[model samples]
Target: MEMKTIYFAGGCFWCMVKPFDSFDGIESVKSGYMGGHIENPTYEQVKTGTTDHLEVVEIIYDDAVFSFDKLLEIFFAQIDPTDAGGQYMDRGTQYRTAVFYTDETQKMKTVNYIESIQDRFDKPIVTEIRPAEVFYLAEDEHQDFYKRNPERYKQEQIDRENYIKTQKNLS
Candidate 1:
């Protein structure tokens, strides 16, 4: 089986894991920091929005079973792509939505997918499409946070779902 890796910065890294975890081809979903200037930034540093790092998830999967396009679809559904500032209740550059593409094919597919869905929203999609950068693994406390802290994670999911519903109604 050929495995491929993709990185996605979609709001709080904690909220990004569970959505992709249950998929058949998915190998692992790890919380990490990317697109940052600092080396080995901690969650505290990135959360401050000063390290220039965005909270991201490093996703590894079997490309033969799970396609990149499917991953894009899942990513887009999780956050408001039009929100340039941040997502849900999290407000910061670190919470912004982005697709960190690792290859030409991933780049092209993401660009096209964004374009095709442009008409669906009144606002322009602001999700960033960029080359994959070094991914610094987040603290152990952050990995699988939803599993570790179910109540907190559930509350976050509720808030995010409500916001998404409201946005859909507006558009």
Candidate 2:
């Protein structure tokens, strides 16, 4: 089956990567930086707020198994679109929320989705929906972080915090 691509920046590419990877239809998720003026900005350079980039995750998924709309739904649930600053625990211009669409189809779909949810929030959605730019993959160490260090990564999971604490008798 053919696959489609969607790129999103909701903050901490670490947190963003796992959610998409868990989706049954998703083929893969890549941590990257986008919407920036500089080319191939390092994690440090971007974090310093020198570059305009936002930490983004590029998702490759089978369109047959999951629709673009479905992906957008999941993305919306993961971050506060109205918060133009940054997501949950992350802060900085590089961690700001954004939606990078590859084509016109994805662009229109994103617009519709944002419009549908507009009234649900008091503030306007600050998510920037634009054409996909060159995506610079993060360092190898950042890839599959959750799988490599179960204990540490599991602790990072917002939902798994209580579960892990209880198991470790630290609750």
Candidate 3:
């Protein structure tokens, strides 16, 4: 009854999925592209940084089960907002971190949330807080990438790759 949605572009979409899915009230987490000018852009065009599209996840949740603030907290905990250029090993506009607010309230909440956590870091938080744009769902192959690519997922787990690197670089 109290459903809401939010968009987060945090580096690799593959690694971003599981974090939000773990929380309650998260009805769905869809990996897609947003904040771009093109229509229904392809993964190749976005991945190659040829388009303005950002790789983001669209999260639908029930506010009664989990507050948006809690979502922001978990999101900030996972990403290095201080990184201006990009996040972790992924270096490109598509890999950049951002919060695409669907409404004025979401925008205000995001700004306030950023202010609350600003003091925690020495450098400025470069995580862009902007209005939500058109979302283009990625190819089916990209959906639940970690689950689909078990061998790569297993290797990633064995190496502790993305998460470890992201945490280490966070200020």
Candidate 4:
């Protein structure tokens, strides 16, 4: 099986893990920070929005089973692509949506997918597509947050789902 990795910065890292975790061929979904100037940044530093780092998830998957295009669809579904400021109630540069492509193929697929779905939204898509950078793993407590903090994670999922519904209605 061919393995490939890609990074996605979708609002809260806590809320990002479960969506990709349950899927087959998805070897791992790790919570982390990326696209920042600082090295080995802590959650405290990144949350303050001073580090220029975005909360991201490092997804390792088998390309033979899970196509990058399918991954893009899943990623886009969880985020409001038009929201440049942040996602849902989370407002900050750290919470902004982005895709850190690992190679030219991933980059092209992302760009093409965005283009294909552009007409679906009234506002322009603002999700940034950048080359992959050093991804600093978040503290242990932050990883698998959904599983560890089920109540809190459920609340977050509710909030995000409600917001996504509204966005779909608006479109």
The C-alpha lDDT values of all candidates are: 0.93, 0.83, 0.86, 0.94
Count of backbone collisions in candidate 2: 0
lDDT of 4 by residue, 124-149 (tens): 99999999999999999999999999
The TM-scores of all predictions, comma-separated, are 0.94, 0.87, 0.89, 0.94
Backbone clash numbers for all candidates listed: 0, 0, 0, 0
lDDT of 1 at 169: 96
Write the residue-wise lDDT of candidate 1 on 19-85 in tens digits. Answer: 9999999999999999989899988889999988999999999999999989999999888899989
RMSD of each: 1.8, 5.2, 2.6, 1.9
Models sorted by TM-score, best on top: 1, 4, 3, 2
| Highest lDDT against the true fold, candidate | 4
1 versus 4: better lDDT goes to: 4
| Model 3 misplaced regions, further than 4 Å | 157-171
Clashing pairs in model 4?
Answer: none
lDDT tens digits, residue span 108-169, model 2: 99999999999998789999888898899887877887777677776667544444356449
> What is the overall TM-score of model 1 with all chains considered together?
0.94
